[model samples]
Target: MRKASIRLKTALLASLTCVTVHAWGMSFERQERCIEGLTPKCQVMILATGQIDKDSPKQFKSFAQTFPRGTWVAVSSPGGNLVGGMQLGLAIRELGFNTTIGNSDYSPPDCLSACAYAFAGGVSRKLTPGSRYGLHQFRGSDQAINAEDTQKISATLAKYLDAMGVDRRLLDYAQMTTSDKVTVLTLAQAQLLKVDTAGQTSYARWKVEVTPDSKLLAINSSLFTVGSQIPITLGILPVPGQNNKVACLIYYKSNDASAFSASNPQHFEIGKEIYPLISAGNWQEKTGGYQATFLIPDNLLIALLQAPDDTVITLSGSFSKPPQSNTTTASTNPLTAYFGVGNLKNSLQALLKR
Candidate 1:
């Protein structure tokens, strides 16, 4: 019985090795498309498919030399070789190419496990509605991997993801999933995790609601922020006692010991105009963080509504140090929030029609 058990283990190991070798064999193909209208133009499209191996990066580098920067690379793979996938992703990024999950025929394709890492290298990563991006726990290629080696590998992966500007929670999700099972990400999940870097319009939308006083409240709670540790909410509503004017309300959260204060100078930069924002009141302590509100002028709110969908509105403020008893010196730190106006006009128009 002992001999039989040893034989079975050896056979299973051999089988796994064979499967890994076959899966690691990746291919690179170049496709061309041209417009034959009044002004003819041609472009090259790269189709990268199959599992990633140690040599995949070198192969891609050689193939990419013939194409120009900003070329589109469509990939379809079941994933293989974690390090190889990361290396391929670096190469793709270095070449300044865009990436999507699909085949040459435009059929729905899967970028799973290591393939997802490779896809992250794109200057602009795009995952269509029908495509799949999946993750799973990392598995040792050989049975001899020790815990120390595993830790090193995990640390390396974390570093790679950080460099790619992806949230580390993605790696946490992958680690929590079993190796035999895959965790597929939805479009919303991808956007929230910073996996979809293409700046899609679906990230934010405007919605309307009626207040208790029978007033129309047009709110866009999905405002995106940068250079800030807390999430911010933005809304537009009628100014109290003013019939023709509307005010923009901005809400943000901060920690109890945070340097943010109502006395800090705040302003909004809408297009080329800068407008001062008045603080609503004192900060209210909340479960996770302290909440504060600011109001934007009606003219600035009109400017925001008239701006293009791609316009980026800026909210700037300063964080001042707490007053000291013995010292008269104080320091101020600058903070800014940037959010795009996406689907705002159409959504507002649709809301008003109701």
Candidate 2:
């Protein structure tokens, strides 16, 4: 078989090997890899949904900083703030994270709008079988847009797809789509569109660290409870650090603080990956300041619902690196990243009502 598309020259990272995933439509599991026992070139940095602002270059910087030389980033979003997608994509491309697209750790995937735009940035991107990506007729609004605006979005997307070396046929189809035809690419289609670079990249050997004040920190928002499968973003940084490993850590807190559960609480870590197919534990420093994304699961909805409304998610984490904790993703444009938070919440409510 052909080697993966990753082009890193680092000595520590040799393409390990991929353990074939035979789970086909078995459970609709969103996370393609649990990563607990598996290894990768490095940990998959994640981004939160609807957090990045459109046309915001700062988002680009945020990702660039987290894993300056990371293997891949998992983008979880309902879509919004796509303007900065171009800049963010460029940043990912420049940083050598050109091997594969990132995947969510806890929740199932439903990437949309700007999230998909950023997804197109990987050197060699792919999606799980059930992954869903959406494209609307308008660039950023639910209101009616003129034909010219639609054309502009199309051209912009075309340029980006081309930059990622996407097949012309897929780009052609995407470019011509009208509002009447919202485009969504399934995982199977993503494979055909984005050439397979599966076993090519991992964050096994990047020069990362956990400083006392690393700029990028994990956003384990305090708005969710246990069993709540939430989609989040893992911001990567590239600044100097104590060790040549990935920064930050992800931890899940159960109702019983006395008990810690890896399967119950999903953590997405950042560090030099173990390539080919590495387990989540392959990297050192399983706890403490690290680049792991801790999210809330949906199964805990009942417990949360029993509590008062607007129950804030209880999350805690730390940052270690240069004291740039205030160092936001550098961007020239104002941003307003959007996600289906409202939609998701509504859906959850509707399910509750049912």
Candidate 3:
């Protein structure tokens, strides 16, 4: 049955019946077989189980060239080389194909470790019922890594997952498990981490923008329950056709009806950086466009939410730019991109009381 759309291909690659090469004494094989009975308007290509090595990407490329865009790539394998898996995964993403754990006969199979990584690169990915999906840390042959190398690898992996719209927390959870012991995620966990997108067509997102016509710097911050320490992302977009810079100093203070008080200072930490409720003179620079992210502190976050229902935090920030040479007013028009609560005051009140 069709879950998502895939383009029909004219040419098909033959499934490999024999070993094409060997790596570390293990024979490697790859196959591309077309699923019969599909309509001419759509197609499914099954990539048979085999070890992924340096040559895997080359083989994948040859098969992919024969197919049209949006083909569903059914992958099943025990997983092998990390480099090869990443390369093949990137190619799958670039080709805009979807991925599933199945074979030419439509039988589900094991897609573990590096194979899971390739599956993740699919524009849309799914794990069929009865199919086994496994994951673990990216490690070397020795199954050990230096602290420096670990940090670098984590940063790169997180970035890749974020770009793929997969939850970066999957990396964190994977780090807790060793390579020898695979972490098999349930379908619920997979859906939570954005690893499984079957039957899902849309997701809720939050964003805030300020235009020249409206410059209140009004932030539509998403309101969560008290003591919820979630990440907050703020973005700044420049007005078109001008040399301009926009900057913001965020301030979260408990406020009465009349004024805001910063006497009880607070701090929010995200990643390795801590941002004070009142920003330091070192402004967050905005060259073309700027984005800043931070995690709300549990204690301070409670204060912001648990306070009186009428209490509000006045967000203060500034934007500056040099005088424009041309008469265009584009420079003055800045947009602040952020998430807004449906009803800022009312929503927070309801959430905090909950």
The Cα RMSD in angstroms, rounded to one decimal, for candidate 3 relative to the true structure is 17.5
lDDT (tens digit, per residue) of candidate 2 on 165-262: 56545655444555344477655566676633443321111122243774433222211111122112222232244332222233322122212222
Q: Cα RMSD (Å) per model?
A: 13.1, 21.3, 17.5
Model 2: how far residue 350 lies from native, Å: 65
Best by lDDT: 1
Off by over 4 Å in 2: 1-44, 98-108, 140-144, 171-182, 195-354
Clashing pairs in 1: none
**lDDT by residue (tens digit), candidate 1, 124-146:** 67776678899887776677545
- Among all windows of ten consecutive residues in candidate 2, which has the lowest summed lDDT? 1-10
TM-score of 1: 0.48
TM-score of each: 0.48, 0.40, 0.48
Lowest-lDDT window of 10 residues in candidate 3? 1-10
Which ranges of candidate 1 are over 4 A from the true structure? 1-24, 32-43, 104-108, 200-354
What local lDDT does model 1 show for residue 218? 73
What would the per-residue lDDT of candidate 3 be over residues 1-354, giving only the tens digit for each residue? 000001011011011111122323112224443433223424446454666665776677666776654567777766676555655666666555667777434323767766776777776677777777777776655334668766765665565566455888988666887766678789899889888875342112323445576632324331111111111233222223433322233322111211111122334332234445433243232332123323333444444434443232322222343112112222221211112222333333332333
Against the correct fold, how does model 3 do in TM-score? 0.48
